[model samples]
Target: MEVRMLPEPHTVESYRRSVLGLVTALPAETVGLAEGLGRTTAEAVTAAFAVPRFDNAAMDGYAVRAADLEGASPESPAVLVRLEPSRAGSPQPRPLRTGEARPVMTGAPLPPGADLVVPVERTTSGRFDDGATVALWRDAKPHIRNRGEDIAEGAPIVRRGVVLGPRDLGLLAATGHTVVRVHRAPRVALVVTGDELFSDAGPRAGIPDSNSVYLRAAVTALGGDVVSVQLVRDDEDALRRVLDSAARKADLIVSTGGVGPGTHDLAGRLAAASPDGTLARVAMRPGRPQAHGRWRGTPWLALPGTPAAAFVSFEAFVRPVLARLAGALTGGEPASETVSVGWPGRAGAVRFVPLAVEADADAIAVHPLGSPDHASHSLSAMFRAPLIAMVGAETANVETGQLVPVFEPA
Candidate 1:
């Protein structure tokens, strides 16, 4: 296979667009609520009823009439006829008439005609003594909670395409949604190719083939519903057979390694396996070399094999493709975030750099990954890198402190 090169390197935006354009061909799907986290919402979910479903008290106190409290103060206190036993979630025994007070518990409904709630501490305490009577002071504004105060029954609770987080889950549950409808996680197939790679550590010279494992985890983290990860030697026949077969069961096909120029590079061929226009090599750096089209009608990305290189490419390219497949908005749309450069930078073409960010009241600062050499010896700075600093080729030289747009995480 001939490695295709462009006269001017492709921009990061160009590559992101390339990947997303391909994935969008595949439409969104619906999945169950049990596994909806990280997936996007296909449709809007409005509340079935009010959040509280009824008026409820904000604090524990006695429900009373404000009229009786007129002229009542520290010097002189207003007295009321104390109604018996009010508990939370229970309806009032009877409506209180003017000048009557109800002993209401926290969260209990206020009696009719009662206009105020006086906490026990705020009011004078009364007790049942021998043949007893008590002096209970009642003075305060209406503490009643009106119906539909918390939330209206038909209010728009959650919108479409919003990624469901833990808090979103609680909101759904509160809305009486035991099962939710969300965009299904796209299923993926990961194939890593390398004759030199090893998966065991028996005093072996080669490390375990981690790119596939990493790719698998990355796919899951990006809202992949189902994934198939496997190793393939640098043989065209073996790779072709496995990838083509996996494509049938998955919506996306991801291959690491064999994307670069070498005697064994097989990324393009695998992507081109299908009759559809699914494979094409793009020009760029590190992960610039890619092939996408379709195998068994499923969108696919053939990624480079370099661990760090493959990772950078995936975040820049592959992940976005997955998002598009799952109906996520990305790449300079209303959903993307912007930031200021924290380091000097430049890219011969579009470049995706590992980034760390610190936010302040005014703006956010971007810390590009130290040079590749800096990352190998110290993995701490590179692992779980959350930012994608997108720099274009037109940037002659990027100086520190310049504002730049960043690809926000999934």
Candidate 2:
């Protein structure tokens, strides 16, 4: 077997495109409004009706003509003819002449001739007592709720390629769309490499294969269904056969482990079994051994064996491709942030240190991975933190307050 090495290391932008084009052509699915949350909209949606549907009152005040309070003063007030109380959803409020006023509540439709709403606080409380109108305490401007002021009928409520969040669901419901068409979630197969990797409770020896479940959950968060997570040893033949079967069954193939430079080269053979597989070197420390390629038009994301490496590679590369393939916007790298940290500066490659983060006026601090043996015990505690200070290539040494890129953990 011929095994080759890459001459140079690759950055996030280097192979970003290689994996995105792998599986961009998938079918879309139509789901109901209840299930559309978090799904990407396939087509642009237009509003069938205006946002308010009618001119409604913003306050519980009296509706009157804009010119009704002309010459009304605090000491010598103008008392207009009063009418019955008009609440919200009232179709017809009694029209008012130049000196006429009516009692109106909040959200009530303005009458045909009513052009202004004077708040009750600005007028006497006894406005509707004994067939007489209250005197104006103070003059108020016209407070009319204009039709289509929020959104016009047939307006574009949501554009195509927008991921539906909670706000989007309300907007769609307001636009009278009970159902929406979204990009269907592609079924995926998570192939865990390394004979030393054990993920299930049935195992007692090798390290627990946490990467399988982690990667599976990551894919799920991006709207992909990891229907099966299969673990394979460093055996090349077994991996090839499994990958071939996966290409036939799964729409996406994500393999974690066995992409590093070592004797056990399972990812390379699995790549060859693919229709047109390729491998590249990632520059970062944790996920530097990451490899990317394709299998029968389906993309193959080959991550490193280390837990941290696999996660960084997936966050740096794989998840973006999956989001785009699912019709979500993902043309760029992960949301990078500037943070501060100190490193030994001996290791050559760029390293990603996962730590708990808190915001201060100056910069973020790098927390110790928190007792390597008990990291899982306090994972949630670390997650509350938001920043991970990054060290660059030219950096040989770092200080406590130096600003660096603070990466967000998924």
Candidate 3:
């Protein structure tokens, strides 16, 4: 196979759009609410019933007509005969009489003809008992929680393409939803290619294969199911076989290593030879050599061999595509943070500087862990920093106290 020359490097924004354009949302599947966490909804979910199904008491008090305590006070109290007690989960009590009061507990359905609830503390006899005379010192406001106050019946509970969280599940449960329809998680296949890598525990001549572990964990954390993880040597024929097998088993194929310009970069060579693939450099620090396109009818992303570059490329490119396939709608822009210290940047390449974030009530700031140029071998620094600061390609250096876009590490 003939090796194609690498094309001009694409900007981060243009490359992201190119990859995302090729993705289509996965099919929807019905799942129980118990298994719905982190799943993206395929359709909008509306409330089956109104929240607070019925008008209920907001406090433990006496259900009474506001007019009864019109002139009530401590010295000249309004004495009213108490009827039956009203507890939560019990049948609705009879309509409150004009000169009578019914003792009520919190969350109990309000009695008919009662317009106000006088807290028990404001009454002389602060007790829930039948046939008792209670003296109210002052008039109290109606402490009733109205039906549909929180969410009205048939109102939208969650919009389409929303990732279900713990609170979302609780709301769905409370709104009478036992099952939800959500997009299926995308199936991913990982290919870690290299000849100088070893997976054994003992000291070996080759470096330990950390890419397999990192890529697997990253794919899982992004809601993609890792179907297979294959480590292939630096051989074109062997790489082709693994790619063919991976295409059949996964929706997307992610390969770490062997995408650089080195002669032993078999992944990059094969990817460039494909009729539908594009192998180009990305204008970014640490991760410049990148290849992506369809291979054997499966989407393929070939990343650099360097650990830091692989990580940065995955977060910048693969993550959004996976989210799209899972039907998740994410924010367009990343949140920004102020820099606590100055850092140098690449002249014509975008800089993804690993940072240790410090957030407080006063301000949120970021401290650079290490130099961006040396990020390829700074795996320890990457581990210490959970956030990546994005500096524009036009900027040569970021000054202290400057705001920069920041994103979470995958």
Give me the candidate number with maximum TM-score.
3
> Which has the greatest lDDT?
3
Residue 118 CA error for candidate 2 (Å)?
1.8
So what's the TM-score on candidate 3?
A: 0.92
If both were scored by lDDT, which would come out higher, candidate 2 or candidate 3? Answer: 3
Q: What is the C-alpha lDDT of each candidate?
A: 0.65, 0.70, 0.85
Q: Give Cα distance to truth, residue 110, candidate 3, Å.
A: 1.1
Please give the ranking of all candidate structures by TM-score, highest first, separated by commas. 3, 1, 2
Per-residue lDDT tens digits for candidate 1, residues 1-410, read: 45443345455566667667666624556555666677777778887777676555556666766667777765577666666757886865677776666667667876776767776666555333222222445544456676678777878877876778888877777777776776557888888888889877677766578787778887877778555777888898898788778887888888887765567877665565544433344444446666666766777777777676677677777876777777666433422334454444444655555577787999776666566223323334446567655555566455666665566544
Error of 1 at 123 (Å): 2.5
The residue pairs found clashing in candidate 2 are: 198-209, 337-406, 338-404, 339-404
lDDT of 3: 0.85
Candidates 1 and 3 compared by lDDT, better number: 3
Q: Model 2, which residues run further than 4 Å from truth?
A: 1-8, 44-46, 74-84, 92-100, 126-138, 153-157, 175-177, 234-241, 261-263, 332-341, 346-348, 359-385, 399-401
TM-score of each: 0.83, 0.82, 0.92
Task: Kindly list the per-residue Cα lDDT of model 3 for residues 316-357, writing each as its tens digit.
Answer: 999989989999886246889888998765578888888987
